[model samples]
Structures are given as structure tokens and as C-alpha cells.
Target: MTEKPRMDVHDLVSEIYARDSRRVFSTLVRLLGDFDLAEEALHEAFAVAVEQWQHYGVPDNPRAWLVSTGRFKAIDALRRRVHSQDVREQVSKRLDELSQVNAERAAREIEDDRLRLVFTCCHPALSSEAQVAMTLREVCGLSTEQIAVAFLSAPATIAQRIVRAKSKIRDAKIPFDVPSVQEFPQRLESVLSVIYLVFNEGYSASSGESLTRADLSSEAIRLGRLVMELLPDPEVLGLLALMLLHESRRAARATPEGDIVLLEDQDRRRWNRTQIQEGKELVERALASRRFGVYTIQAAISAVHADAPGTAATDWGQIVALYDILLRSAPSPVVELNRAVAVAMRDGPAAGLSLVDNILERGDLAGYHLAHAARADLCRRLGRTTDAQAAYERALELAQQEPERRFLKKRLAEVV
Candidate 1:
């Protein structure tokens, strides 16, 4: 008889680790009540799994196995810290109590651990950059190097930020529980911003061969849904809606060969109508509440695009008007760049080029490749081949993603 191909035990462990690591980590944090201890215990448990699962085959309940092992690991570490028998006995007693409580409350408590963990990482005491770094590292399970690349910072800098953030949480005694209703509004904004940042990175990876990091985007959306379920805030709904609306077009965002297909060129037929419809409904709800914020406005803008049958059929005037509102609400150079594109659609390429130049003159986006790429497209349309070629070359130098680099190179070839 022919033998079936044997799966590599290491690969099997890796797959299980990838799928269950977050869940197991959440439970560990809850049990240990210390980030540093929980992280250590979690890794130790996984290491033990690598050794044991090879001989025993994978556990029927991998997450449970990891969590139990992590809990014991934490107890062992605590025992080692205190040489006194009395202290060890006290620690053992506490562990017994915790284990019993966990057994009784595991299902419900584990479900909420992630939400609580998110709130703790996004505590206002931490700087915005630190909060984002911590969330990406702890909650999203991204490595420091990956977080650094996503945000265009050095890995050491990102590592320092995460370490400092964790130290602050410990020093300040930040509670690892959801904020009260009174403090929810302020804290929710930070949480939403982190989630949106994650989604944006996933939607358009900073540097890579692939145009999209679907896993990151999907994780962000999942977190958004969890936030909405727990809080149900208008802004949270809007945030989720915005993500869904953008994700609905993900199917058509790039060519089969992974080159970017501009919004005007994407095949609209491939858009996920279900997500668009849900996003539109959420946008309407947020708008009706009149308590909506930046996310809702962005979702409203995306809703307009999703409603259009084609690029020409899009409501450019409304889009430009929405951009005007967005600019007034949350002003940024990136917003201005997008508004310029809308203005171009509404007015003319010359008008857009003029705004792009103004942004460049201010040095607001001097190193941003998209800014130069937009200028190149406008220059090409206006028959200024020399200027277009220079802009494209600059954009190509600044571009990090392989697909974007290819596209810029192609544009430069045309102008040359």
C-alpha cells in the first residue's frame, strides 16, 4: 500500500501557533495580570508545545493546552522568584483560586480579554505613537520590525516606543479593563485611530511585493466589529463602515499581475456589493446621529464612490464638498492631497496641479511618493513630458512597494 505523505511536525505546530497564539495570549494575560509575565509564559508554553506535540501529535484543544501550560509556567516562574516556602505556598494558593475561577469563567472572560487589552494599550497616558506601536505589537501580534516598516521608522525606535509604553502601563498602574462610559468617548477615538491605521497598512502595504496585506486589514475589521459589539458608538459604526466600503473594492484594486488599477480603471463589477450596502447603512445611521466624526465623514465619501456605476458617473461635486468637510474637521497634508484629486475630478488637471504644487512648496509631503506620482500624472495629461518624466523618476525613487515601483517606472518610460 502507498503511504500517505506525512506532514511536518514543525509545520503543524506553526499552523496551530499562528491560529491560536492570540487567543492563548489573551487568556494568559488575564490569568497572570502582568504583560511581561504573560508574554514570557506564552512563549514558554509554545516552546513546550514544539517539544511535546511532535511526539504526541497536536492537541485536540490546542488553545486550551497552551493556556493551561502558560498558567503553570507563570506559577513556576513565581515559585522561582521566592525562595521562602511560605511565599511559595501563598502563590500556590492564589494560583489554585485563579485556576478555579478561570475554569468557571473562561468562555465569557476570554471573549472580552482582547477588548480590554486594546483599551489598556490605547490608554491616553501613552503618546499616540507609543499607543499605535503597542497595539500593533501586543494586540495585533506584529513584530517590532514589521511595525517599524509599516510606519516608516527604524526597528529600534519602534522597539523603544513599545518598551516605554509597557513600562508606563506598569508604572501608572493602568487597569486592564474597558473604560467607563464617562471616559469611553476620549479613549474610543484613540482605539479607533489605531484600528484605522492597521487597516490602512493592510489596505496599502508600505513596502512589499504585494499591494495588499489582507491579514492585517481583516484583523482590523474584526477588531472594529468587536468594538462595535461592545460599545456600539456612532463613530465605531462609522469606522467599520468605512473599512467595509474600502474593502468591498479590494477585489478590483489590482490587476491579476498585482499592478495597481487606479480607481478610474478598476472593474466595478467585481466590487463586493454586500459590504458596500452594509457600509452605506452604517454611514446613514452615523449621519443621523449627528454625533459622527472623521470616520463617518470618510465613510460617507466612500459610500458616494460605491454608489457610482462608473468613474464618470461619480458625483465629483459631492465628493469635493465632502473633502471640504473632512479638511475642516481633520486637516492633514494627506487629506489635502486627496481633496486635490477630488478637485481635479471636479475642475481640471491644471487646478489639481496647482494645489499639488502648493503642497510641495510647503514641504508638507516632500518625500511622499503619491504626491509626486499625482503630479506626474497631471503633468503627463498636460503634455509636459519633461516635467512628468522628472516627477515620475522622483516618485519611483520614493516608492517602496514593488508593484507601485513598476507602475511608476512604466509611467516614466511613457514620458521619456
Candidate 2:
């Protein structure tokens, strides 16, 4: 007869990491009363768990164990700082009190702490960029390197951003609970934008060795669901739909070797049917209410792409019409660039080239990588080798992502 080994220890550890991450973070936030300190405490506690869990066996309540460990670390860190004697004594007393607190009460307190931490990170007082970096680091549990990829910045730059954001949170005395209904819209919009940015970064990494970061995309999706649950709105549904549609194609967006695969060239058969179905459902629901935002419109465009059986079969005219609506709703250089691509598809490469050249003369997208790439593509289509070669070289010089740079270089070589 075989005995089932006690749940594999490594598996148990991983489960603990997942189930208790928020709890650990929340408890640390309360104990330290600072986002950066809380995060530092949480990691220190995890380090201890990795070392001690194997010897002690999994605790009956893994989250409670981690929370307790983090709280202790927070107190120790405070005590190490040579503050006023009264401050030191107060912290010592608090540590003693924490040791005596009941585990059940601590767990309940941790929930409230997490809610407070969320509101604080998403505070309207902070700039949108700061709010995003802070919330992702504090609420979504992303490391600086992961956030850097998401923000399209160097890791050091991201670290500085997070540091400055936390300092602002502390200095501004940002409230730690949800704002009143009157204040909710502004705060929530900031929060939602951050989540969407996270999803976008993962969906199409601006620059990375890998084309995607599933962890970030999943985290953003989870955060979106949570946001919608807490405060359901038409815009929230629009964001959810947009993310679902984008994520559906993730499986087909890159080659086996991690090269970029343009949407038209992607293997539709490789798309996630379930995600596509769910996304379509959301888009339908959002559209039924007759409340279409930028996200909804973008999702609708993606839906068109998803529904088409092949590139040649695509409903380009409809897409061009939608882009017309989108431009009015949210006029940006990037949106204009995308509109140019759609126009090229519906008309001809020459028409698209005219629009792109007009834009270049305006010098609005001079530093934009996609503009150069788009021009190169249009020139290639028109069989203008000299123009194509120069455009590809320009794109290669401006391209940030390694894979995209490779793509541009390949195009240039072919032209040469």
C-alpha cells in the first residue's frame, strides 16, 4: 500500500506565497505605517519563510504566519532606527502589543489594512505616474524590474519613481480608505488607468527579451476584475473587454523564437477561443448600454480583427469608420498613426504613405518608433526600395525593443 506524501513542501510553499501575499503586505503596511517599509518587511518575512518553513512544517494558517513574521520585522526595523527615546519606547510597546494580539483579530485587521493601502496608493494627491508605480508595487506586488518593463523605463529609473512616489504618499498624508462618492471618480480613473497601463505593457511590452509578461498581464486582469467588483461602471466594463480581447491574441502574437508577429500574419487558430468569447460578451454588454468610451471603441476594433478569418477577409472599411469615431473621441498622435495603418489597408500603400509623410512634415512623431516602422512598411508595399531602406534604417535606430529592432534590421537588409 502506498502512502501519499504530505503535500509536497515546495508546492505548499508556493501556495503560501500566493494565498498570503496580500495578507503579508497588508499586515506589514499597518505595522510599518509606510508603503516602502511595509514592502521591505514583507520580502524579509518571505525570505525567512523560505528558510524556516521547511524545518517547521507548514503552519495551520500560512497567511497568519507570514503576517506575524512581517509585523515582527517591521517593528525590528523601526527599533533599529535611532529615533527619540520616547519614539523608541513607543515602538517597543507596540511590538509587545503585537506579540499579544490574537491571530484571528490580526487576520481581520489585515483586510482593513489592505483596503487602506489600496486607497493610499491610488490617492489623487499623487501624480498619475506616481500613483501607477506605487499601486503596482504596493497593491499588485510587482518588483521594480517587472514594473520597469511595464513602464518602459530602466530599472534604476523605476526604482527612483517608486521611491519618490512613496515619499510623496507619506509627505502628502494621503488617506488610506476609499474616497467619498463625490471624490471617487477622479481617484478611480487614476487607478483604472494604472491597471490598463499594466495590462498594455504586458500585452505588448515596449521593450524586453520576452515579448510578453504573463505575470503582469494576469495581475492587471485580476486588478481590473477587483476594481469592477468594487465599483462597476461602463468604463470599467470597457477596460475589461479591451484587456480580454488583447489577451486573447497573446498566444498567437509571437513566433516560437520570440520574434514579433504582426496581427495580420498571426495564426488565428492559435488564439484563445475562450478569452475571445468572453471578450465579445463584454463588448456586447458594454455596447448595449450605448456608452462607448475609448476602451470600448478600441475593443470593438479588436473584435473586428478577431472575427475576420484572414487578413484578406478583414472588414477594413468598417475598421476605418470606427477609427474615425475613435479619433474624435481620443485624438492622439498614436491614434492617428494607427488610423494611418487602417487607411493604408483600406485604400493603398500610396495613400497611407501620403498621410504618413504629411505627419512627418508636421514633426509630431519624429521620435516615435512605430511611425518609422509604419513608413518603412508602406514603402516596402509600394516597391520603393530606396525609401523603404531609409525608413527601415530610421526605425532600426529608434526601435527600443530588441525584437522590433531585429525586425527593422531584417527589413533594411532585405531592401539593401
Candidate 3:
């Protein structure tokens, strides 16, 4: 047999690491019961894999192998720490007990580890920002640099936040299991918010050359599916449905040259039929439950768009109604801005423009680029060329993503 190329070995190992790193990390978190220690063990296991897998060839079960290796690494690190002998003995004893579990049981436990990790990261004890940062880093497998870029903050600041969040988790002794049914509803909202934040960043990146970060969006969808499977709450289902409905249009959300394509202009043929079908079904299920919340209403609105044959055929009135309901449940300037857009489609450009102007006068979303961009679009539609030009200029100055800036500049040229 021909010898396998060395570069192929490196590529294969990298692929394995990318694919199984989060799973391995989740399992290690369960075994170690300390976020920092589990993270250290996970990296150490991969380092060992680089040396061992190259010589011994890949393991049949890479996730299991990594988990076991990480456990051993954690035990070794514990022994090295200058703590009481009792502490060392306790960890050693736990490792010994874990080692005796049958492979079948261990595999089952590993399957549930990701869910536990999600709940732990979204614990109410942590602040909302910290919960989001921790979930993005630990569950979504994003680097601090990537998270910082998403947050528009320095990497050091993001790093410090993650460190503080992890330290809090350890110090607070947050349990590594799903919250009880009574405690779950309050906790679940935070978990869903973090997942949506991840998806939004992926669906329309805040700053970068590309408009979409498919990797981040896809990772969010994967986590959404995992959460839905583990806990079939109505809102959880709604959240997954909402993401799926939006993601179905990913292919058509931008032009080949990477310019933004407004939803009304996007090619319906490019939308993922399978995802739309699934999302619509999920929306129905959520709505029928009557226990559905904000996410379900948003999914219903997306369903309306998806069901329409074209923009002219869209049920804008229904969308506006849904937005009204959404606003009542989760009132925010952003939701109000979206509602204004829907109101424009339902009523007229003048109606939408009036709402946008009111929002601007209130000075709530004055610095928000999208608010300015929306105003510019409305101004252009109403033949207010000078106002449109100024608004576009403001949007261009505020926009950070290259694609968005390019889009704003293109709009500005048309008005000028």
C-alpha cells in the first residue's frame, strides 16, 4: 500500500479537531466540574492527539477518545496543583469511579453533556453579556478574537469577560445539569437569546468583508437543534423555527458580488425549500401550543413571507399585526423600527417614513446605522433626494462591515 502523505495527516487531524472539539469540551466540563480546568484539559487532549494520531492513525471513536484523554489530563493537572491532598484524592477517586462505567453508559452520558453545558453557561447567576460571551465561546466554539469582532470590542476585553465568567461559574458552583422544570422557563429565555445572538451575527455579520458567516450561523442552527431535542419547550421550538426560516434565504440574501439583496428583491428559487418547509411546520406546532412567545410570533411572520409567491403577494397586514404583538411582548427600539417597516409595506411609504422620523426625533436609535439606512431608503422612495443623500452618508459613516458600507455608498450615489 502507498504511504499516506504527511500533509494529509495534518489535514485530517485538523478536521477532527474542528468537528469534535466542542463535543470533547462538553464532556470534559461534565467530568472536571470546573470550566477553566475542563478547557485546559480539552486543549491538552488535542495536543496529545496531534502527536499520537499521527503515529497510531486516527481513533475509531474520536470523541470518546478525546473525552477519556481529557479526563486523564485533568487528573494529572489536579495532581500538579498545590492544593490539599484531600482535593487531589477526591478528583482521583472520581476519575477512578468514572473509569469503571461501561462504555454504553459513558456514551449515553456524553450525549447529554452538551445540553448540561448549555444550561450551565446560561445560568441566571451570570450577567446577560457574560452568558452570551460564555455560550459563544464554550458552546459555539468561537475564538475570543471572533467573539470580539462580533461584539465590536477589543480581544483583550472579550478575553477578560470570558475569564471572569468562567471564574464566576466555578466560584458559584453552578450545577452541571439541566435546570428543573420550575426553574427552566426563566433560564430558557436567556439560552435562546444567546443562540439567536449567535445566529444574527452569522446571518448578517456586524463587520467584515463578507456579509454572512455561514460557519457561525450553521453552528447556531446545530445548537438550536440540540436544544430542541433535549428540551421541547414551545419557545425553544419557536426559536429553532425562527432561525431556520431566516436561514432558508441565506443563499439569496446577497448577490454573487456580495451586495446586499433586499428581501423583496431576493430570488425565491434560491431559498432552501426543505428548511422553509420544516420551519413552517415548526411554526404551526408552536402556535398551536398557545404557550408560544416572541420567537413564535416572529416565526409566524417569516412563515407569512415564505408562503407568499412574491413580494407583491406578501401579506404585509398580517406581518404588521404580528409585529404589533411582538412589540407588546418585547418592546424595544429595534422592534419598533422593524414594525415601522412592516407598517410601511402595509400602509404606504409615507406611513413608514413618518414612523422612522418619529424614532429619529426621539433620538433612541440615532447612532444605529440600520435606522439611518432605513430612513435613507424611505427618503429615496418619496423623492426626497437631498435628505436621502444625507441619510445615506450618515449610514455609510456608521457602517463597519465592508459589504454594508459598499451597499450604502451605492445607495448614496443613486440619490446624489
Candidate 4:
């Protein structure tokens, strides 16, 4: 047998940062009882790991090591600060409790810390807008830029919202406990939206070398299952079904080398029938309830595509109807862009181009790359080469993900 390659300590730490930084941060929040303090401790622990791990070698349990180190760092910081008599005594008491809690793992949080953290961030104390921004920024590890893209707002605005949310949590001393079962309904919408946005980031990474991040999408699906099990509501079922149906296409979504395979171009034989069937069943149940939301309607649209054996067989008319319903329910520029694409399939390029132009003229999705890419495709189909080239160029400029950028370049080249 060949010898196993030795991994660099730095690379290992970086990999762990990508995978478990948020996880460790969540646990640290539980241990230290403050988001800002926990965040600082997390970075300090990782920095120390880089220098120390080289000499000590990789620990058998890196996460545990990081957590322990973070806790020590926080305690040291607290010790360094001078406080009033009452404040000092309170700090001493809290530190004693922290040490006791660390020794007794059974006393610690039994629930998934991320789940608890998400619910905590979604507390009614924060506004709905702040809740989404805070969870996406803190819990999901999304950049403020990514959160802004999801919200179609300015990055600075999203950043301020997150800052304000964290300050409120700290000032109010919000209990980070997982919300009770009854409180799930009140916070369910915000939680579901955040999960789906996480799924979106994974399904189509907003930026990065890879087109998809399987870990993020898988976690989103897992959360969806947990939510459905606890809530068993129509919208929850609908959201889960929507993710499953989209995930079912993952295998056929890209080439082995990681180039994107557009939905119409992807090979149907590679689709996961099991997920498709399960998603379709859930969608049916959710639709039957008539209480399903936009997610259910979107899943119904995906079900229409799943039933088709090929792109040509896809019932675009039915999809357009679903889009119409979805637009009425949600009414976002993104939804309108999607519906315009569907209308192109049902009618002709000219018809879809007209709708897209109307949307653009209204100053909606002006900065969204996908909107330009869709416009490019429609223009290309209509033999409007100049318009296609300009649209493709705009998309290429705005696109971040490498695979998508490559695809745009290829389309731009074709027109040139």
C-alpha cells in the first residue's frame, strides 16, 4: 500500500475553520454567555492553534481543544479587566459556574447549539428584519454581503442591522435558550427563510471556487427535517419538499470537473428519484392543506419539472401558472425574474424579453447577476446578438462564483 500523505497543520486548521468555526463559536457563546466575547475568543483560539499545533501536532479532538482554549481566553480576559466590587464578584461567580458547567457536560446544552442559537437570534426582541440578518450573519456564517444579496438591501444596511441586533441581545441579556414548542410558530417564518437562504448559498454558492457547498445544503435539509418533525405544519412541509426537490437534482447539476450544467441541459438519468418522489409526496400533502405558502407553490413548480423526462417535455404553462401564484404570494423581483424565464419557455423569447425589460425598467434587480444572465439567454435566443453580448458582459462583471463566471464568459464568447 502507498504511504498516506501528511497534511500540513495550517491546512488542517483552515479546513476546520471552514467547517466548524461557526459550530465552535456557538458552543463558546453557550459557555461564555456573550456573542461578541465568544467571537473574539474563537479567533484567539484559532490563532493560538496555528502556532502551537505545529509543535504539539494535531489534537485527536480539535473542536474540543478549540472550545477549551476559547473558554480559557475569555476567563483570562475577564480577569484582566478591573471592575467595581459588585461587578467583580459577579464575574467571579459566573466564572465559577462556567468551570462547573464545563466539568459537567450533562448540565450543558443537549440540543444542537446551532438550532438553539438560531432561535435565540430570532427572538421577538429583535425585529423581523434584524432577526434574519443576525441569524444569517452569525449562525449560518454568511458574509454581510451575502445576507444583503439575499435581502436585496445594501451591505452597510445589513451590517448595521446585525450590529444593532447583537447590541440589543447583549443589552437585554436575552436568554439564549431554545424557544419552547409553542413559540416555534411565532418565529417559524424567520427561521424557515434563513434556512432556505442557507440552502440557496449551498445550492448555488454566492461566491467561491466551488459551484456548490454540500455541507451547507445538507445541514439546511437536516434542519428542515428537524423543524418538520417538531412543527408538522404545511409551510414547514412545503419548505422541506422544496429543498428536497432541488437537492434531488444535485447529481446532474454539474460536470465531474465542476462546470455548471444548466437545468435544461442536465442529464435526467442522474436525478435522484427517491428524493424527487419524497418531495413530490410532501408537496401534494402541503397543497392539499391549502395552507401552504410560497415555498409550497415553488415546490409544486419543481414537481412539474421532476415529472418531465426531458426539458422539452416540461409543462411550462403549468409552471407559469405556479409562478403567477408564487408572485402573488411573495411578490419579489427575483420571483418576477423567474416567472419571466418560465414565460419564455411557454411563449417565445420576445414575450419573455418584454417582461424582463419591464422589470429592469422598473429598476428592480438592477445589480443581480442572474437577472442579467437570464436576459442574456433570452436575447441570445431571439438572435439579438448586440443585446445578448451586453447582457452577458454585465452578468460576467457581476458574477462571483467561478463556475458561473466561466459560463457567462463562454456565452459572451459565443456572441462575440
Candidate 5:
């Protein structure tokens, strides 16, 4: 067996940070009873870890050690604040509350602290975007820039959303715990939405040089699994199935050189059949319940595509039908755009082009790069070179991801 190289204390501590920082943070959040303070404690603990671990070697339980250190750091800060007359009473009360909460915290459920944190971050008191932003920032440990790239929004915008979310939580003093069974239904949508967005960003990065953020997607999948274990809701199963099905194509979604690979051109042999099978099984389970929603229907569409031998053999009719149901249930412009692409395959490019025109005429998805790219593809297939060129140019203009931009530019060149 090959021996692993010994890392310096600094490097080892950094590795520990990458692995256990979020777990430590979660425990500290439960102990400190405040997000900002918990965050501060997390960093302080890490800074202490680098020095302490070097002098005493690594601890047998790094997470527990860090959690202990972080809680003390928070306590120290709280104590210091207690001496300030301006906020003495307020700080003293907070310290008492923390002490009591921490005492009862373990008996309640310390192991599920991260899950509780997710629910708290996804609280209904916040806006949809704020809920998503906060969960990604805190639970997933994604950076502000990373979240911004996934959302295709400006970093400043994402940062401000997160700031506002934290302010709301602080000002309102939202509890750092999971919702009750009755409260689950109300908070479920935001939670699911946050996970879905995370998966989408990881599955196909919205921007950046790389085509995929595998780490982020894997985290989302883990979160999905965790949520399913807790709730097993039909929609949750559907979402999990949808993500697995889509993720199954990860190997074939791009060239080894990191260029984009259109679904029709991807090598089916390279697909993860195991994930496909599991995803299909999940879809069946969700469908059997007769209570599934858009995600389940979407997974059904993915299953049809997965089962196909090739593009020509795909069940475009089934896909279009599923999209129809999704549209009726959700009724969004993006869904209509997708349905149009399916129609183009099931019917003809001309029929699909008509739908695309109608959507564009209504000023829907005008800023969406995929909508333009879809139109460009239909136009190209229909031999409408002029229209294809224009659509591809528009898509290229809007595309932020390097791979997508390259693909659109290539399409534009071919049409021209």
C-alpha cells in the first residue's frame, strides 16, 4: 500500500476546516443560539485549532474539540458584552438564555443540528430568494460568490439578500430549530426549492469556466436524502428522483476537455445506469402515491429519455405530455419553453417555432439564455439559417457559462 505524505500542521488544520467546519458551526449555532455569533465562534475556533493542534498533536475528536472551543469563545464574547452598561442587561439575558438552551440542547437532538439549521434558514418569515440564499450560505457552506454564480445574479445582489436574511432572523429572533409536523407543510416548499436550486447549480453551473460543480450537487443530493429520511413526502421523493436522473448523465454531459455535449450527442454507454435505475424506481414510488407534483412528473420525463436507445427512439410524446401536466400544475414560462422543445421533437420544428414565437411575443423568458438556445436549435434543425444565426447570437450574448457560450458561438458560426 502506498503511504500518504505527512501534511504540516497548517495544512492539516486547513483540511480539518474543509471537512468539519460546517459541523462545528452547526453545533456552535445550537450552543451560541445566534447565527452571527456562532459564525464568529466558528472562525475563532479554527484559528485556535491551527495553534493548539500543532502544540498538542491532533485531537481524537476534532469536531467535538472544535465545538467545545467555539462555544467557550462565544461565551467569552457574551461575558465581555455583559460588562457594557449600554447593553449590559441585554447581553446578560442572552447569556442566560444560551446557558439554558445549551443545557437542554443535547436532550432535544444535537445530532440533527444541521437539519434543524436548514429548516430555520428556510423559515417562512423570509422571502423565497432570501430563504434559498440563507440556506445555501449557512447549511451548504457555499460562498457568496458561489451562490451568486449559481443564481446567475450579481454577487452584490446575493450578498445583500443574505445580509437581509440574517438581519431578519436576528431582528425577529427566529428559533434555531426544526419546525413542528404541522409546520412542515408550510416550510416544505422553501426547503425543497433551496435544494433544487443547489442541485441545478451543481449539475450544470450557471457560470464559471467549469461545466459542473460536483461538490455542490453532491451536497444537495445528500440534503435530499436527509430530508427524505425525515419526511418521505411524495414531492420530496420526486425531487430526489429528478436530481438522481439528471445527475446520471453527468459523465456524458461534457467532453473530457470540458466543452459542452448536447444530450443528443452524448454517449449513452457512459451514463450511470445504476443512478438511472434508482431514479426510475423513485419515480415509480412517487407516482404510486398519486400525490406527486412537478418534480415527479419531471423525473418521469427524464426516465423516458434515460430508457431511450437514442435521440430518435426517445419518447418525445411522453415528455411533451409530462411537460403539459407540469405547465398546468405550475404554469411558468420556463415550463412552456421546455414543452415547446418537446413539441418540436414530437411534432416538428415549425410547430415548436410557433410556440417559441408566442412565448417571446408575450415577453416571457426574453432574458433566459436557454430559451434563445432552444430556439436556435429548432431554427437550425428546420434549416432557417437566418433565424438560427440570430437566435444563436442572442443566446451567446446572454450565456454566462463558458461551455454554453462556446456551444452557442459554434452554432452561430455554423448557421452563418
Candidate 6:
């Protein structure tokens, strides 16, 4: 059989960014001397790449080409903005100097630029939300629209957040370099959360045709791996494991027509055994450390799912026990709701209904779709078709993702 040439779009995109991301980002940072402007310039450079790559072919040194192009574009932009003769001259002189940079210096400069960008995006000056938005947009190459969707906010709001975050970083004079080991722990949680958000967005896309956003999930995993390589913490290991185990079920999470598949009904044969094995190893390692966090606990839950051969074979009692521990560690309405599901599986639907009713009565999850979905399921099981239909309608209204909404609507149809 003849071998067919294959081009991996994901790897191609990653390589293009990796090679140019630092140098181009640095050029913009140096040229505009602002994180926001540098980020904008980098976006502009990639836009041009998308346009030119079809005809020109990817350059031998695509990174260098992007850096050079972005630099000139930024210089032109700066020239247009500056009316002052002195400022123009300063910009021109800096441009000329950067153009004449030596090879060794360029390497060092690019490294400095990347390091500066990473720390700047994660600066203590910005709020955690802003830091996450800025880092995903600037460093991770996600569009503002994509970011806004991920954050469940308006695009304009996300844009403003990024702009404000950049301004804060500049005004606060946040150091461009990576923090020392002594300062790592203080900033670690924010970084981990951002990575976790990335994985989640992929696991269930905020708005997309597909059930799983593999790119976002893979990017999160990649970033997680990078962080673990740089600093191996138990929590980081746990997060990586969690993402992997969830991702392993991607193939079985939806039907051929793209309808949602509940975990119980998903074909176990379709799951990625390799990812399951890898995630299990990570969980075991994390448990051995005895220094696990919320991510580890969540990973442990996923590990239980992976261990079970089938839905009927699952240890619901063990799952309920884990949820109890999780409730103590992370007292969230979502955790409680999940516990209710486990209770239904272990004890009975009536018991689960009581738990869900208690949560809903408190108005803690007034707009959460899953809460309604859980109620609908329990009501349906108890032969309360009218109540089940109402609950499903509520779920459909609150559901953000199309697939989830469709799933709820289908459930409503089944009862009505």
C-alpha cells in the first residue's frame, strides 16, 4: 500500500507559534514596549500568516519571518500613533537597533521576551480572572471571542478585562522575569486554576457543534505537563491526571449524530485505555505523596470511573463516600448535586430527590442546568411526568451548550 502524506494541523500550528511566539512577542514588546500592543501585534502576524501560507508555503524559518513582519507592522503603527517628533525618533532608533541585533543577542532577547510575557500575564497586580483571561488570550493564542465564550461573558467585556489587566501590569511595574522558587507557592493556585479552566472548556465546550473541544483540552494538558516538568507538585499531577481521564472518554461522550451520551450508556470499548492507564499512574503517584488537593480529589473520582468495567459494576457506595470527603474539602453546590446523583445510584431515586429538593429550596443553584437535569431525572424515575417535563424545560433554558440543551429537550420529549 502506498503511504499518504499527512499534515497534522495542530502540531503545525504549535510549531509556528513556538518558533515565532517568543521572538515576535519580544519584537512587539520592544517596539511598542507594552504587553497589550505586543499581543495585538502577534495576533496581526498570525492573521497575515493564515492569509499567506496558502500560496507562499510555510517559510523555512517561519518564526523569524513572523517576528520580522510583526516588528515592521508594529513600527508603522507606533509611527502613526506618535505625533511628537522626539517620540518618533526614539521609535525609529529602537527599530533600527533591533534590526541590527546579533544572533547570540537575539536568542537571549527572545528568551527574555517569552519569560517577560509569561510573568506579566500572571502578575500579582491583576485579579485572578484578569490574569486568566490575559494569559489565555495573549500566551495561549485563543481569540477574544473564544475567551469570552469560555468565561461566559460578553466579548467586549473580555476585551476590556485584557486591556485593563495589561494596563495594571504596566502601571504596577510587575517584573517581566519568572518568580524565584520562594515566590512560586503564592502564585501557584492562580496558574493551576487557569490550566484547569482550559481543560474544562475542552471537556465540554461552552459553545460548539462538538461535545469535546480537543484543541482546548490538549492545550491545557500540554500546559499542565510543562508546569509539572518545571515544578512537580502533587496538585499539578492531580490536575493532569483528571484532564487525561476525562479526555479518554471523549470518543464515547456522544452518539454518531452528536447527541450527548450519559456516562452510564457510553460504550466502554471506545474509551482510550492508554489515557486511563496514564491517569491511573498519576493518581497513584499523587496519593503516595499524601499532599493532594481538590484537583487530586477530583482525579480520584475519575480514577474510580476508569476502574469500573461497566455502569452496573460501578461502586456507587465508594463514590458517595468520596463525594462526602469532597464536600468537606470543597463545599460547593455542584459537589452536593453530584453527591445526590451518587446517592440515587447507591440508595434510591427518592433519597436523591430529597437531596436535590433541599439544594433547590435554598436557591443555591437557581440557574444551574445540571441541578434541573438532576431533578428532572429523579422526577421521571418517580413517575411524575409533568414535574419532569417542567424540570427538563428549565434545564433546556439554562443550558449554555447546544448539545446539552438538545439533550434536555430530548429528555423532555421522552416524558411529554
RMSD of model 5 against the true structure: 5.1
Q: Which sections of candidate 2 miss by over 4 Å?
A: 1-17, 23-33, 36-116, 124-132, 143-164
Candidate 1, after superposition: displacement of residue 25 in Å?
Answer: 5.7
What TM-score would each prediction reach against the true structure? 0.75, 0.76, 0.80, 0.66, 0.78, 0.73
Candidate 4 lDDT, tens digit per residue, 22-111?
878888888888888888899999999888787767776688788889889999988877479887997999898898866224313423
| Local distance difference test scores for all models | 0.86, 0.79, 0.86, 0.84, 0.85, 0.80
lDDT of 6 by residue, 77-177 (tens): 77788888898888778777766754233555665565556566777778877877877777666789998766567999999998788777778777666
> Please, what's the RMSD in Å of model 6?
6.6
- Clash totals for all models, in order? 0, 0, 0, 0, 0, 0
Order of quality (TM-score): 3, 5, 2, 1, 6, 4
Model 4 ranges off by over 4 Å: 1-118, 124-170, 176-186
Please give, for residues 148-215, the per-residue lDDT of candidate 1 as tens digits: 77666799999999888888887888888888989988888989998998898889977877788787
Task: Give a tens-digit lDDT track for model 5, residues 267-338.
Answer: 999999999999999999999999998889999999999999999999999899899899888999999998
- RMSD of every prediction: 6.1, 5.1, 4.7, 8.1, 5.1, 6.6
The best candidate in terms of TM-score: 3
Indicate the TM-score of model 1. Answer: 0.75
Better by TM-score, candidate 4 or 2? 2
Candidate 3, residue 352: how far the Cα is off, in Å: 2.3
